[model samples]
Structures are given as C-alpha cells and as structure tokens.
Target: MEFSLLGPVGVATGAGELVLGPAKRRSVLALLLLQPNITVTIEQFMSSLWEDEPPAHARTVVQGHVSRLRQMLAEGGAEAYGVELVTRGSSYLLRLPEELIDAHRFSGLMALARPESAPQDAVSLLREALGLWRGPALSGTVSGAQFAAAAHALEERRLAAVGALATAHGALGEHDHAAAILYAEAAANPLREGLVAALMQALYRGGRQSDAINWFHRTRQLLGEELGVDPGERLTRAYEEILRAEAVATQPPARTQPPARQQPSGPVDPRVQPAPERAQQPSIPRQQGHAPAAQGRSPGSGTTGGPGGTDSTVDTGSTGGTRGTGSTGGAPDRSTAPRFLPRPPARFLGRETQLAELTRWLTDTGSGESPIAVVTGPAGVGKTACAVQWSHRYASAFPDGQLFADLGGFGEGAEATPTAVLREFLLGLGTPPEQIPPSADAASALYRSLVARRRVLVVLDNARSSAQVRPLLPGGPGCATIVTSRSRLDGLVVTDVARPVPVQVLGTDEGVALLGTMLGHDRVAEEPDAARALVALCEGLPLALRAAAAQLTARPRWRLARLAAALGDERRRLSLLSAEDTGIAAALRNSVARLSADDARLLSQLAMGTGREVDALAMAALAGSDPERARDGLDRLAEMHLVDEAATDRYVISTLVQLFARDKEAGEGGSPPASTER
Candidate 1:
C-alpha cells in the first residue's frame, strides 16, 4: 500500500485515503508518518506534542490518540494499514514500507520526475504527485522538531514538482504553459528570482514577448522598492534583450495544423492579447514563421489558440498593465513560485566575452539550434559567477522559470551523487517527496522528459564531470542549461555542447574596474601605484579582490598603501584574503575541508609543486604514490578549485592560490617546497 504524508495527513492504501482520527490524533499520525519505521517513545511524543508541559494523564492520552489513529487507518479496510503500530519496549514503533508514508512517497516520486523520462510520463507523474498537497504538510499544527523536518521535506518535494513540471513544459515546447506556472509561483514567492526569470523565459518563448519584456522592469522595481537594490546585471541584461527584441525565436504555435479543439468553459478576459513577434524595429531582422514538427504528441491532440490570441487578460497570479494589490509594478511582488537557491554573488570581475558567448549560445541569434552551454575554468577563476550572471542575464529566454543546484564538485562530503542532486532539482521544480521515483536512473529519465520542450534554464553549477551532469540534462529542446566546472565536459554525447569557455583571472583593466566598484574609483585613482600593487597582490582573482574590498570596507582608516604592504608579505596575504563565508582563503579551505583524507594529502603535496603546468608524473612523485594516486589527487585539487586542469594531464594553480598555499605551509613551518623539474 502506498502512503502520502505530503498533504493534509492521509494514508493511501489500494482502497483510498484512510481517515485518521480527530485533529490531535491526525497530528500524532502525521508525526508518526514523519518517522516511519522508527520507534517514538511516549515521552518524546508528548514533549513534541506539548513542548512546555502535558496533562498528568499524558501517557494515557497519547495511547488514546494512537488508538484513534489505528482505527482510522483500519477504516479504509486495507490490511497493510491495519497491520501495525507496535509497542517496542516502552515506545511505539510505526512499521511500513518506505512507499507507504506520504512523506517518503513524495520523495520517491520526485526522484522519478527527473530530466531523462518521457515528457508526457514525467509531466503526468509530477502533476499527480504534486496534487497530493492540500496545503503545507500537516498544516494547522504548531510545528515542533519532527513537524519542522517533515515540513522541510514536503516543501522540498513541492519545489521539485514545480521544477519537473516547468522542465517538462519546456521539453514539450510548451512555453506558455510553463510561463503560466512560473508566473504564478514567482508571484507567490518574490524572493526567488530564479522562478521569476524562468517565468520570463516562458513568456518570451510563448509569444508573450511583451509580457517578458515588462517582467524585468517589474523585477527591478520590486528589487529596488523591496530589497533596496537594482536588479543584478544578469536580470538587467535579460530585460535589455527583450526590450531590444533580440530574444531567441520562440517555440512556434504548432506544425501540421491540428484540428481546433473545443474551448474550456471560461469567458475570454478582455485584457489579454496575442503574444507579439520577436525583434521589433532596430533589433535583429525578423524571420518567416517556421514551425518545427512537434515530437511525442499523438496525432489527435488539438491546438487551441493560446490566451495571448484572446483579448482576455491571462490571470496566472501575476498582474499586468494595471497595478493590482501586491503587484510587481509597484513593489517587489513575490510570485507564487517555489524558491530555488540564490545565485552565487557577483564577486567575479570581468570576462565580458565569455558572458556574451554564453548568452549568444543560449539565444543562438535567431538560429534554430538547441540551447546548451558549458563553462570551464581553472580553479578560482570565477566560473560559478559567470554561469550565475549569465543565467541572470538570459533569464527571460526560459520564462517557464529557472532551476539551480550545486553538483558538489568540490564541496564538503561526497561529490554530490547525481541521484542526490536530481532529488534536490526535483524539489526545486515542485515534486512532492512521495512522488520521487525509487532509483536515480528512473529519476534522471523523469527529469529529462519533464524539460523536453520548456524554456526553463537549469544551471548545474560546480559539476565534477560529465557523469555528474549527464543525468541532469533535459531530453527535449526548449529548455536551456548552463554547467560550470573545472573539468572540460567534452566528448559527452549531448546536444549543443558548446565549446568550453576557459575562465581566467580578470585582466588588468577589468581587475581595476572591479576594484573601483568595491573601493572608490577616486581613492584608487589617487594612488595608481598602490592600486596596481593591490591588483598584483590579488593576482586579478575576483574572489581575492572582493575579499580585499570587504576588508577595506570594514576598516575605513586603512589606506590601500597599507593593505598593499600587508599583501606583499606572503605570510600575511592569506590572512588578508580571508572573509567569513566568502573569500579566497575561506573558499579554498572549504574545498580542502570537504576532501577525503587521501585527496587532502594530495592537495597539500600538490600545492607545494611548482610549475606553470604541473603534470601527473611529477605530482605522483611528490605524493610518494603511483601515477594513479597522483592523477586522483590532481583531479581532487581541480575539483576543489585549488589547482586547475589546464589541458590533458596538465595542472596549474593561480598565482594567488599558490601563494596562499605557500603561506599556509609557512604558517605550519614546513621545511621547504616540494621539488619539481623546472
């Protein structure tokens, strides 16, 4: 019997939703559902139920609640439901298959709704699984620790469901549908620009090009009014593209001209208009309307005119034209969308060509090519921010919405397994936990199918390898994806794998501009010699520059001259580059801390290796291990961004990074640097 804890408490057997007891009893059942297959002692239950205190007969009262829950489960007449809520020495144990609990079920289905599945199947499965929610998981209960955990799990599932649906619509080339979903969600959750951007993409692709153009304006207005800032550079660029009418060609209405279908029983609101053609005057020249043959759809599914064709205003949650109550036109109205994680900060300095190239690839300059781009860089060269900013810029192209996840290429713990990343991606898409499939492969299939033709942007940041990103690719064409990694994901058989853009440190001009932005341009210009010295010390690394800027921001009295002097000493440079959560030193340490013991040792040894390019054989010799061990260490270091893989079997470290590592070694009072054939 399958169970679902994703919605208002209900246990589904083959029969139907088994009614639990009263609110108290339902609460108890919900708690049990959260920890299925685990024993919850009476004391723990009571404390969770009533944190401060409980009645003298709390134990008996708990028993009564349990009894009621049992009867409710049995009411559905399913043997599995009636089977057991057993007594294990002084505690009650709930035993059921992982699939029988709603929360668990949601997780399973989310896994199933990945990028690789057939589009129709993934959409149907994701929507069905997400529909289980009546409201928040165990709504109406004052959450304690157990409820909190369950709620987080359920919310994650919800996001996964949305992500799956958004992706599916994109894959199927249904940008209008995707935009509607994304707009609704973004309005509900304004803090999540990723969703807003996704909706913007859908709008652009759905022929609602005007709506997409206006969205960034609304976003900027919202961010300024609510968040006290301008829309970031990425969002700004997307807006500029729409205004300029240079957006990619939208998925056409249909090919083969399917028979018109009966309309649903709703009046066409007068406010909506047919989506406009892309490229207004002065933009790129317009092209003749050409429709790609539809895939996967059976011959009979009818093509009705979209709402854009109707005069009715499409009320998919977001307000248009007139400013409604809580509208983005006035303030930063939160869209009714699930929040994906925020993009990495723009600590990155330069590389405009890389950004333009990425944008060009995604939009393809009216060329009818599939959209996929990969970003490659040496360690600490700022690939993640490039991907993040690029997504921010072309967000409108994918209007169904945006999805982002770190593949944990160099993060703490295990390199993020594809399955784990897919699980998170599904949640971001809005899959309920109970709906995620059982296996990673199944989840990957589902993920691909979901994004077959939607204009959603999936940013797989900090990936380790192609295997890490392969299962994550959406099957159909409408969706676009950007992956950032140290390794070159060449030779991977996927469509539109653009040439890897090698992210290097900022050039002198870009580095200086970056510093000017952080520290005052006036101050830096006043001391040109000192400014050049500071940039040199930072080695034009964006992270290091930001860290330096942050430090200077904190200490107004310290001059750039003093700061330059501190950086001149290798012993103090690492300290100068340290910031709490964001800094060159801290980021590197995080990468180091996450490594396996073997990997960590290898990194430390490799750090001391000197060369413009450190090869595997020399690295292996330094590690006192064989070629394989050395290669593994090199790979680990590359993933961590401490050392970069420059080319086949050649590794290099940034000037700042090498100095930082050297400083760290000196602080530890190491004898000498590891030897290398110069």
Candidate 2:
C-alpha cells in the first residue's frame, strides 16, 4: 500500500484506491503521514482538527477517527505491506517507511539535489520531485486553522523545489527552460523575492535585458508599496548587474535542441547561482566593505557593535535619524559586527530531539517569513542552555553574526524593556547612536530595515511576554529568532505564529549521564545505584543535578551515597541542592515571590495534598474556594510551572517544587480554613 499526502490523503493498493471514511478521518491520516514513524499525541490531533477551541470530548472524537482509519487500512490490505497503526501511551503512531509517502519522496529527492557537483542529477531528481505534486497539498481534506497552516507549509516546499529545479537547469546552460519555469512560479508567488530574482536572472541571460530591467522595477515598486521595504540584497544586486554595459546584449539560446553540457565553466557568479543552503531566498552578493568579526562582546555591556565602538546607552532625546533610515552619523565603526551569544555550558547534555526541531525551523524553505521559535519551560530546565548550544553549533550559517539579549524576565532586576533591546540591536547592527529612534515603534522599523537583507540569528532570552519579544523580531526572511521564556507565551503562538518548544526534565539515564559528565565517570561508576538515587531526588532537573554534582566534586572524599542520603530528606532537600552560585531553591523562591497572595496560598495548599495529582474540585475543597476560583488558581500555577496539568484538569506538582511550597506553607503555619475544609 502507498500513502499520498501531496494532494488528498489516500491509501492505494494493487486493486485500486481505498475508500477512506469521512473528512476528519482523512485529516487524521494526513497528519500521521506527514510525520510518519513518529507519535502524534492525541492533544496534537485535536489541535490540528479543531484548532484552538476543541470540544470537551475531543479525546473520544480523536480516538474514533484513529479507529476508523485503522479499520480502513486493514480492510485495504495495509497489513500485507507491513503498515501498522499502533497506539503508544497517550499518542498514536503510523508506522511506515519513507518510500511509502510521496511527500517524503519529494523531500528526499530535493536533499539529493542540493550539492553543486550534481547539476544533471539535481535536474533529474528535482523534475521527479515536482511531478509528484498532484495539486495543492492535502487538497479536498477537512480544513482547520492548524491543518491549513500545515498545508500551506507543504505548498511552500513545492514552490521552493520548483525554484531549485530551475536553478539546476540554468547551471546546465538551459536558461530558456529556467526562465519558463520561473515565469509561471513568479506570477503565482509575487511576494517571493527569491523567485523574482531567479526569473530576472533568467530573463537577462536569455537576451531580454530591457524586459529583465522592467521586471526588476515592477518588483521593487510592488515590494515597497506592499511591505514598506526595498528589494532585498539579492534582487538589488541583480538590478545593478543588469545596468552594466557588458551585461546588456547576451544572445538568446537556440530554440532547437539544448546545448550539450560542457566542463569549460570558469568562475561562476555567486549571485546568479542558487544557494541550496537557503533555497527559499536568493543568495546575497558578497559586498567588499564589511567582514564580520569572529567573536563579539558579551550581552548587557550597555553597548553593542564591533570592538571599541560606542556603548548603546539609552537616550530619550527627540533628535535622531528618520524612521527606516539606518543612519551612521554617530554609529560605531562597521569593521566588526556584534556577536553577543554567551558561551554554551561545557557539560550540556540531552535535548537531541529539540535541537533537530530548531534546526528544521531555521532551515525550512516553505515559509516566506522569518521563523520564530519559543523555548519555554520551568526555571532551570535548560531552555537557555539548549538554545545557546544550538546557536553556537550553527553560528557559521549566519556569518553576519548572532545578536543576544537577556530580557531579565525572571531575574532579579526589572524586565528588559522592548525599547531598550531594540536600541541595542540597532546599535549592534551599525546604526549610529544619534540616528537611533527614541520611540520603540520607530526603532523597531529601523532595526527591521537594517537586518532585512542579512542572514542573522537573534536570541532573546528570558522573555516575559509576547509583547516583549514582538518588537525584537526581525521582519524579513533572512533572519531567525529564538526566544526563551518561563512563560508559554501563547499570545506569540497565536498572533505571531511562533513555534512553542516546551523543554521537559531529563529521563533517568539522561540525568545520570549528565551527572557523570559533571562529576568524574569513575566516581559515578563507583556508586551507580546511589547516582540514580541522587538523580531521582533531584527530580531530573538540570540545575538540581548540576548542584548535586558540584557539591560532590567540591568534596572528593564524600561518597555519592552520603549525598543521596542528604537529598532524601524532604525538609533539607532544597538546601542540599544548593552549591556555590547554583541553587534550585533560590530559583523556585524567586518564582514564588512574584506570585499573588491568593496564587501562593493555593499553590501551598495543593502542595500539601496527599496524592501526586489533584482536580479543581478537590483543590476547591482543600482551599475553601469555589470551583471556578480553584480552576483559575490552578491555571495560574501551571503557567508559572509550579504545577503541571498532568491530564486535563488533573494537576501534578513535582516532588522538588512541592517541597519548596511545603516549606513556605510550614513557615506561614498555613492550613485549609476550618469552614472551607470538607
């Protein structure tokens, strides 16, 4: 049996196409096929089916769809081909090889076509890939907002493949063929500057210099009027090249048989060549004036830019450069660019899955807009560490340099205001200090204009809310931004389409490995059981694990069992997990201190409950409040990561967090009010 998601979701057997039931069932199959061999959680299915507002019985509905799909597959002889719909825990997995899915085949072909050494092979592979798209992806399937987003992403991939195919043809001296392919695609996607630039290049090379120049002017006018931004560096370079005298009169290729491939090519112009690394956008021509520095200053220096540039102190003066004009009147020297990422932790471990997701988001060619990813979790779950590590690993992708800022959302001081961050970003991007706009809106516009044409990564750490990160986001497709926050920032997900990546605690094995990395392998090996026990006591939190490992390392004579025993005591565990500057207790305390009195009281009461989980009704009985109030309090606690919603309304507080809450409760001598308790 073969699956198709390139158009309508379907299953095909030797007999013919099988009849998949209802629209929702087809949608379920489509979602599963898109992520073949991976688990699609029930929650994800519901979200994609109904979007933000799911029905109360969404679980039952999703289970029905899955059951129907399984029945259809089985009747269609999917078992003969080794297809299986397996239920794993709270998720469902559709087990199928990559070859069985058309979308996967297309992706595979595109990957094989990316190398510069294989233009002929690329042309063949890309042609096959393009032929697989029967129509708009997942067409005629049930549509929801989430499903629409996924379908849009698939369509974007198809267009990118088209662009790549044309590039491959051009490399083989088939300019007319490239021009024909790009012409139709460009008309279909007017906002795609990369496609537009490719078409312009093809037209100029095909002896239509005047027509190419006309297209450039039309594109520039459209982009400025629609997006309020000029044509990107690639398009601008193409226009400049066309203005040169020698480039005006190249003869058109013969309309007969195509010329044979030859190896006499000297140096290829980088501007005209397709950049497989950034297939969604045309490659920017290398300019002569600026070379990015190898390293930049640490964040929070009140100044950002190349070495020895002026500091980015906040200025409230009305006198500044015009909006959208990156003036350099008082700007720092442009010899060095700002590289603000902090060095990643030496002993970083785990998060392999999350790193892969981030990589895909950064390199995805389907979306025409700049990608935004939000890394969120409780304090010390390693959100920042994971982001920094990935940024450093892929730093070379953004040669223009990385920009880093600490929003101070959960730290000691006031949160870093968006205006302040924008100011620093503009300065770091070489906008003169005097030319920086005083208003945040104007500064943001200027910052977007400056980085619109460059490939850069902006890491916004500890963002308090969506509004805080919004102004800092770059406008164009050439950049990607990663924001780490304790809050989930749901508003950003809904409004700005930011991808939310929740970082969870490590598993037992991962926690143990981290301890081994921090402490000596021999030491952990000496007391393997004790090391596992310590990990359990620390609850697999990176900060707690690091703290425990630091204490043992500082006192080499202390046995791992002794440290484990110390952590076993609930009353003293928080203190035991504090070593040097790393303190899990301090972090929890800070989070609690920011909460309202009612929320704090609710959290403490819930922490004292007998079982690991509690529903809103039980919480209300315990807290002597109505169910509505109890539910609201629980949601607030969950948002702050003090309590996690294990399943629906059932909430689970981690052992370590419970201990902190209990400590506070004991200190306050708090208990349920006599009238409120059952």
Candidate 3:
C-alpha cells in the first residue's frame, strides 16, 4: 500500500488506486497520512480544512469522511500491508510503514543524496527522489493555512533536492545537463535565492561566465523592483566566486538558514502553572460556586464594531453562565449603570487564601493605583472560576460597571487580539459604535479617556499574553482588573504591577471533598477507600475530579473503584479523561499545541523517559542537545504548564499530561530520546 502527498493525495494498494471520494475526504486522509501512525485530532482536521470559522457540524463532517475512507481502505485490503486507520479518543491514527508514504520516501532519498556523497550515487538517488513528484504536492486540492505551510515546507525540501542534484551533475562534468536542470527549475521560480545561486554556478562551470554574470544582473534588477532589496548572500556569493574566476565546489557557499517552525497538529496544549512539590506546598486551591451575575447596562441594538476589531467581536454571553438582559454585541444603554463582574464559579472548591489576598490588595483604597490581579494556572486548573468567584464576592466595592473579556489565549479558537478586545470594552462602556475608532491605539486612548474616573471591574479571561491585557486595563481610582490565564503573564507583573495569584490543582483533601460534592456523600461513604483512590487518580485537579464524579453519577452502577481502576494505567488515563468529557486531555493538548516546534519536539522526547522527575541533565540526555537547550526546554515546558518544576533542576510531569505527551510521541513515531535518560 502506498499513500502519496507528493502530488494529489492518494492511496494505492495491491488492489490499485482507491477512490478517495470528495476533496475533503482526501484532505482528511492527506492530513492523517502526513504523519503516518500518528493521531490527528478532529480540531486539527477543522483547522486544515478551513482557514476561517468552520461550519457547525464540522466535526460530524470530518467523521463521515473518516468513516468512508476507512471502508474504502478496508475494502482495498490495506491491512494486508500492515496499514489500518483507527480512532483513539478524540483523535484518529493511521498505522502503516513509513516507507509507504511518498513524502517520507522523498525525504529519505534527499537525505541520502547529500552533496558530500559520490557524484554518481548522489545523481542516482536524486533522480529517484525527484522522480517521485507527479506534480506540485496536494495539487488542485485546497486546504487551510496548516496544509499550506506543510506544502510550502515540502516544496522547499524538493528545491533543496534539486540544488543537490544539479551540483552532482556538475561533479560528473555534465555542465550542460546541470545548467539545463537549473535553468528550467530557476525559470519557474525566479525568486528563490538558492535556485538562482545554483543556476549561476552551473552556467559559470559550463564556461559561460558572461551568461552567468548577465543572469545575476537580471535577478538583481528583479529583486530591487519586486522585493526592494539586492541579491541575498547565496546569489551574491556565487556571483563573486564567478567574477574572481575561482573554482567552486559541488555545494554552493552560503550561510546556513535556521529550520522552520514545526506545525503541531492536535488540540492546543494547556497553559502550565507552577507549584511547589505537593509536600513542600502548604495548600493549593480550585474554583467552584456560581454567584448571581452582575447585569450589564441595557444593550444598544444593531451596533457592530469597526474592521480592526472583527476578531475581537464581543459576545455578550455572561462569563458566569448568566444571561445579560440584552442582545449580544450591542452598545450598552446609558440609562443605568451596568454591573459587569462575571458570576463566580458554580462549584466552589478551595482557594480561600487567594481570594482574601485579592480582597485585601484591591480593596485597600489607599493603594493609589488601580490594582490588577492575575490568577494564573494551566488549562482545566480553574483559574477563571477562582478569579470570578472572588470578583462576585467583592462586587459591592466597584459600583461602576464591570467589564469582562475572554481573551482566547489557551484554546483551539483564535487568540483574541488587543484591538478586538478594546472595541468590545469601548462599546460596553456605552460608546456608540460609529464613534469607535478603527485603530487599536486610538480605541485604547478613547476607552481610557472615557473610563478615567469610573470604578469598574475588568475580568480578562484566557489571555494569551500580557500584551493582550495591557490596553484593556482601565484607568482610575477604586477600579481593579482581574485576569485569568494559563501563563503567569510575568510582563504584567513587572511593568504594570499586576498582582499574581497562581492557581494549582486542588490539594488532596479539597479534591476528595469536591469529588464527594459532585458524586454525593452516600457514594463516598460506600466507597471510602475507593473515593481516596479516585482522588489520587485525579491528582487533585478539580476538572478531572468533577468529570469522574459526573461519570459515576451518570452511571450509578459503576463504583468509584471501577472508575479508579480504569484510570490507573498512565497510557489510558488521558483517553479516559476524554471519555468522561473531563477536558483535561483537551487542556493538555491546547498547552502542548502552543509550544514552538522545537520545544514540542523536546517534549515528545522528554515524555519518552521512564521516571517522573527529570532534571536538566536527564532532559539534555533525552534532547540529544546541550544542557542549555534542555534547561531552556524544561523551563519553557514548565511555563506552559506541560511540565512542573519539582526542584531547581528537576521537572515533573503529571500522570495525565505524561500520557498525552506519550500519545503525541507515538503519533509522530519515534522512540524515547533515550531509554537511559531518566
């Protein structure tokens, strides 16, 4: 069986090419086959299929396509070649030999066709590699940005192969063949500096120095007009080498470029929150308890924001699940002062200390500056619930309107830009839509001007970065802003003096009590030991405990031990979390998804280890890089809440997060960075 992404995405088995049906079905297959034996989440499919907002039921559509593809692959006897597509949790995995993928095969051939290889052998490998392309990859098939980026990355490698091939031809003393190859490729892609450099060298080697020089001048003129720059180093280096009449080597001389960012395909990883080791820490808190939502002023009808704020369009949905008595996304009515504090959490857990701290700091009145409080934690860690719960408790202090914006920093959806958020806040403050300025700076200035003396409460939830929350900070005395985010938003702390309250998973006792509250006291009484076991399984995360409770409540026949037993295995824990709709797995994915390609790769490597705590040395061993890189990666992972710093150099992975990481590693198909690293 062969899966091809080199040209049109296709599957060819011993039965011959199988019909992939629609373009999207092929796209689904193409994306899955992009990394064979790896799981592609439905969210990733939606991301690859549509660049903008996907239609409702996009998940169902993707499932239908996957179902049909499965039937076709089964009927085509793909299993005969050890290939099969299967679903795991919220993701799909395709198991097959990597050699069966044309893209993978192409890469392998390129690696072997190095410029350092013997010219004859290199030529053979290059021709075979180049021959695999029937046309441009994913030809005639439209896809979203991720696919486009992947295709662009693939095309780059193909060109690199072409350059290596041309150099081989030159080594074989077939300058005309080399020049011909470079000429045709360069003609089509006149802007690629590498291709131009190779073409120039090929012409020079063929005793056509004047021809090469002329080509350089032409390219130089084209670059100046089109790109507003002269030739880059590669083109210039080849030109100078030709001018000096010096002999050149098989490979072109140019500065090595950095690798491109790797595109991670899955649910975004959760934002990481730091915590002391369980024993070292005295307490940790989770959020619960839904308070009455403070109402917004009457909304003005038919108001929409300016173009610059489109992505930041405000949804008037109460963050606390309370419905505001108004239409969504309208200007606030000036008749009554609005109370905008989001309703507090519905299921309040522990976090008394943090709440009191917020109350003391922000309510001081004599602090001289508006107090900004940030509640930081990983996704599913209940940061938002804690922040809002506290906000509702102190609602009487800020009689002015309360403002809330869910800056989608850590989730599958687009991260909210500051400009978009400002528009919504401005409108919420009763500024007419037409009066709203188009630029972020202008809008921010107007908003600050209008809010100068108001004692408003601003709750910015799910913020991606500190920069996103800065402009939304209102000015005035008696005003306070509370932000909930995965990152610590250190910049806000440093520059804006935002107070940070880090939310960790609930402590053991609080987690068990919360679980009992969800499942009922009788259930806990009946399975006393089992209840404790379940809490340990949940690892003090309220979201996980709530999910486990909900799962048990829905199926009363299932004992707590049964659920506990199910979650005992690390590998299946995340899958179980998904099954229970616990949100931990998705949160983990969201956090992981935020990492840079290199950092994500390092995470997968680190997850391949055996022990729970891995210091920089162990991480370095797994990273197969320097200690500095491993330390940096560990710190980065910890900041994202993917890993936790247990000590100065030691990092720890939660049971659920570790499972998700292993799943990602398995999907990408690699062994642990090293078996001995841990």
Candidate 4:
C-alpha cells in the first residue's frame, strides 16, 4: 500500500483509490502518515488532536477512530498484502516510505526547482510542487487545535511553493512574468517579504526602473500604515539597484525617487532591534506602472532600508553599492509610533517578591547567555502585569523599542499570525510594505538582519505554542524575550536553552497587602478575619484578590464580611466573584474553556485527587500513563493555571479551581479512586 499524507490524507494502490472515511479518522491517519514508520504515542496524538481540550473518553474515542481508520485501510486492499496501519505502544505508526506521499513529491519537486535549474525544468517542477496542494490541508477535519496547527504548517508550505516558483521564474529570465506572478502573490500575502522582493527584483531587471522605485514607496506606506514597520533589506537592495542603474543612464529618476544614496560603511542605528536567527533578506516593493523586460540576475545585497531608516549592514553584497539616497523613497522615519497601539495600563499592588525575582533574572543576563524567560501562570495571576512592570523598569537596559505581540494561546480570533506580527515589526523599524517578503522565512531573515546587533526586549504575550514564538524571537545576544501565557510552552522550554518560570499565586501576606491597598488599611483591619477568609477563598491569587477588592469597592452596601460570606460557598463563590468580564472567575474560565476534553477530565480528576500538590508520577498513575506522558498532561493543566506547581515535582490547583474541579468530578459521577501511589 502506498500511503500519502504530505498533502491530503490518502491511501493508494495500483488497483484504484482507497477511501479514508470521516474527517477525524482521516486526521488521525494523516498525522500517522506524516510520521510514517514511527509511533505517534497516545499523549502526543491526543495533544495533536485536541490541543488543550478533549472530550471525556477522548482516549477511547481516539482508539475507536484509529480502529475505524485501520479497518478502512484494510478494506482498501492493505489486508491483501499483510500491510496494515496499526497502533503501537502509546501511538500509531504507518508502514510507508517517502515516495508514497504527495508531500514528499512536493518536497522533491521543490528541491529540483532550484535557481540553477533550466527555466522549463524549473517551471515544470514548480507546477508539480504546487499541484500537491489540495485545498487547505486536512480540509475535511473539524476546526480544533490539531487542525489549526496542521493548517498553519500547510500554509507555510504553500507560501514556500510560491517563493520557489517565483525564484524559478527569475532564474529562467522571464523577469516580467516573475514580477507579475509575484505581484499577485504579494498582494494576497503582504506579510511575505520574499514574494514582494522577488517581484521588485524582476521589475528592476525588466527595466521598469520607475515602477520599482514606486513599488518601494508603496511598500513603505503600507507597512507603516498597517503594521508600523519598514521594508526588508532584499527589497531595499533591489530598489537601490534600480535607482543606481537609472543614474548610470544619465536619466533623471522619477520625482518620487531619492537621488542615488551612498552606502554608509558603519552600523545603521544603535536603537534598532535585531532580527531572529533565521530571517531572510527584506521584501520587494510594488510599483504602479512599468514592467522592466530585462533578464534576472542574482539578487543583490547591500545596505537596504525603508522610508528614512537605514537598514543594518554586516558587509553583504548587493547590485552595485550605489548608496543611493540613504533611504527608500517616500518612506517615513522609523521613529514613529504605531497608529493603534494603546498606552500600557498602570501596575497595581502586590507581587513585590515576584517582581524582585524578575529583576534578578533581568540582571542575571550576565551569566554567559541571557535566558528566554517565560512567565506562565493561571489567568489573572498577574503574569502579564509582572512582565510589563519588569519591562518598564528595565526599559533603559534595552535601548531598542520594546516589541510586543499577543500569540493568543487561549483566546479565539486570529492569534497574531507570526508573519503578520513580523510585518508589523519590520514596518515599525522602517521597512516599506511593498518591499516586505511574502514568505515567513524571508521575513524572519530580514528581522534577524535588522536586529543582529541591537539590544532589544521582546514581550510575546499569550503565545499559543512554540511555533508562534519561534519566528518572533530576536537573534542577537543582546536581545532577550519575555513570553507570558497561561499555557506552558513545553516545546520551546524543552529545547535546552529556553527556561520556564512558572508564576504562582501571591503569597498570603502579599495577597492581603494588595487587598489593603484597595479596601484601605482601616477597612481591611476592621474586618481582618473576613479579609483572611476572603484571601483564602481566593487561593491567594493576585488577580482574584484584585477582583474581590474591586467588587467590594464598587458596592458600598456590601461589607468585607458579607462578601466573604458570599464567596465561602464554593459554587456561588466563583459566580459571585465573576463580573460581566475582567475578573478572576472570567480569567480562569477563559483559560479552562480553552482546554481539550481530555485535559478538562484530567483536571477534574486531579481536583478529586489528594494534597495541595500532585507530582507527575501521581498524575500519571491517576491518568494511567507513565511519568513522562503524565507530565505532558500536567503541563497542559498547569498552562491553564488550573494547577500550580508549588514545589518541584508537585502541583496544586487554586483554592477555587480545586473546589470547582472536585464538584465537577462529583457531578460527573467522580473519577476512579485517587491513586495513593507516589
């Protein structure tokens, strides 16, 4: 049987086509095929399927799905040859090779469509590679965490295909054709600088000099207007060449074009943030008219920039370093503020100790290499506040502007696409929109180029996964990132360098102090017992404390004691603490609601289990898995901030979460008896 999953999940045989029934079963099959000949493990598979939330009996359900898939495969002729997709220890793996999948074919064609390939061959290969895309990847699957991630991966590949095709056309010397094709691609995906740059370079080669220059201007405008960023270096270099070539012909450049600027020999700007390790050169700009009909040449390198900003240089080559008008034509200065960015809110009381620890970490950057610290905790645990406060305090340390992006690990809506975020970032640094690359890889390169030598602080808030954060991380040693999320970024943290700092609830004293700040010493002191009870009920969570205090302050008739009485009832407590929105209960729910059914069930079981803290071993026993697998489940719980790791190898749920989880378990007829082991 020829198994396929690179694009579209399918099973093939010489006889005919094999049907992979149902979307979820197909998804499980696709995932299995993607990792052919390897076990996917139950834990990893579930994580892929549900992300954070899974239904009760998700495991049994997955098993049923997998069994159905295997049965389908068998009916489709796999049984004839004694070939079958089967479940192994913890995971399922398909028996297949690289040649069977369309994904592999696409990758193979991509490799053949290199710059050196003949025009005809390159075009053919590009077409072949593109042919593999059969609508959005896993089109049949339901919208969930696994599908979301798979879709993102597929989209990345699609963009890569566009870039490859454009490059092949450039090599084939069809500059105009390449430019036109890339133009449409860029328009559709403005965040991809590679596509944008390709179009610009093609235009320049095709002798559309004026058009190239205009493209640079338009790119700058779009980037600034939309994302507050600048054009990338590749686009900058391509436009720079157009200007220089025009100068040599003794032809006056368009009024919009700046005079041929001379290249500066030193570093660009001291305040510019550097790029991450993998970004390519800048994007290409778009011109209104004029399609040059010249042959394509190797992409030039040199000092390229957006609007008035000078792109950083580390001695790369470009089409004749004409140093033309030190900046992209008609571009804005890089020093402008983003149009829609709101001023940060002020910090409140409590978190003195946590703040100090953060400061220490900031200062500890002196230890060999700075750590990419993750501030993770329950929602409303003040993770964002702590990160923001620390960033504000240490603003002087990172002279570059503070970069912020919310990855939306827990919320809905487009969780700031990495490319979109990069575009915004580059525009802010001064890249023109037209010049931006139409590919994530190219944008990442440009970002790294821009920040290769600067000291910058990047704060990634609400990151959904390591993939989202990977592109946004700045490249230089001088750069440090602080990521805040309710979910623990296990993938990033496990990579040896990045470490996680799990933010716990405020200590008892700190919680009381925060309440004091809001209710006043006189009021809090007058109801000391009530205040203590209130803090206890809140589980010493900073956000819960603040919300409780806000509630009391809002109602003059309600005394602290009365509020405490309302909160003492577990079920009514969360309901009582809840406001229309923006309260402890709401925050916790936001995190919890994002969970997959499996995680929710595990959490409920945890609440039904023993002690203030449970180790991975205990959870594994309760969840009926090994410690390693159990840890992954626990990490998911911890990310929702439903469970806190109070001690190394131990975990605890917030007081309210504990009560709620237990109540939920009982409501669901409770979990199997809590494991006393470990």
Q: Each model's RMSD to truth, in Å? A: 23.6, 27.0, 27.0, 22.8
**Each prediction's TM-score against the native?**
0.46, 0.52, 0.52, 0.48
Q: Model 3, range 1-678, lDDT digits (tens) per residue?
A: 888888888988776888787888888988887777878999999988888899999999999999998999889888888888899999999998999999999999888875555889998888888778866787645657777888898898888887888889898898866886777567568778788788878877876554465466556656766898877888878866764453222122322442232222222112211111111111111001100111111111112211111111222221221212112222323323344444445569779988888888788788679889888877787888888888788777766567766666675545666666676665565443455677777777766655566677888888878887888888766588898888878899999998888888887778778977777788788988888888888888888887677556434567889889988877667765654222678787777777777777788777667877888997887778999988988887787777899899999988777777888788768643322211
Clashes of 2: 2
Q: Give candidate 1 misplaced runs (Cα > 4 Å).
A: 1-349, 365-370, 413-424, 427-433, 490-498, 593-652, 660-678
Runs with alpha carbons beyond 4 Å of true place in candidate 4? 1-347, 363-371, 494-496, 608-632, 645-651, 659-678
Candidate 4 local lDDT, 96-174, one digit each (tens) = 5557667777778877776555767777777767756644566666567666776688678767876676677778777
Cα lDDT over the full model 2: 0.72
Candidate 4 versus the native: TM-score?
A: 0.48
lDDT per residue (tens digit) for residues 301-376 in model 2: 2322211233312221111122212431222222334566765556888899999999988867578789999998
Worst 10 residues of 3 by lDDT: 283-292
What is the Cα-based lDDT of residue 36 in candidate 2?
88
How many residue pairs clash (N, CA or C atoms closer than 3 angstroms) in each of the candidate models, in the order given?
102, 2, 24, 77
lDDT, model 3, position 138: 77
Candidate 1: lDDT over CA atoms? 0.60
Clashes of 3: 24
- Per the 3 Å backbone cut-off, how many clashing residue pairs does candidate 4 have? 77
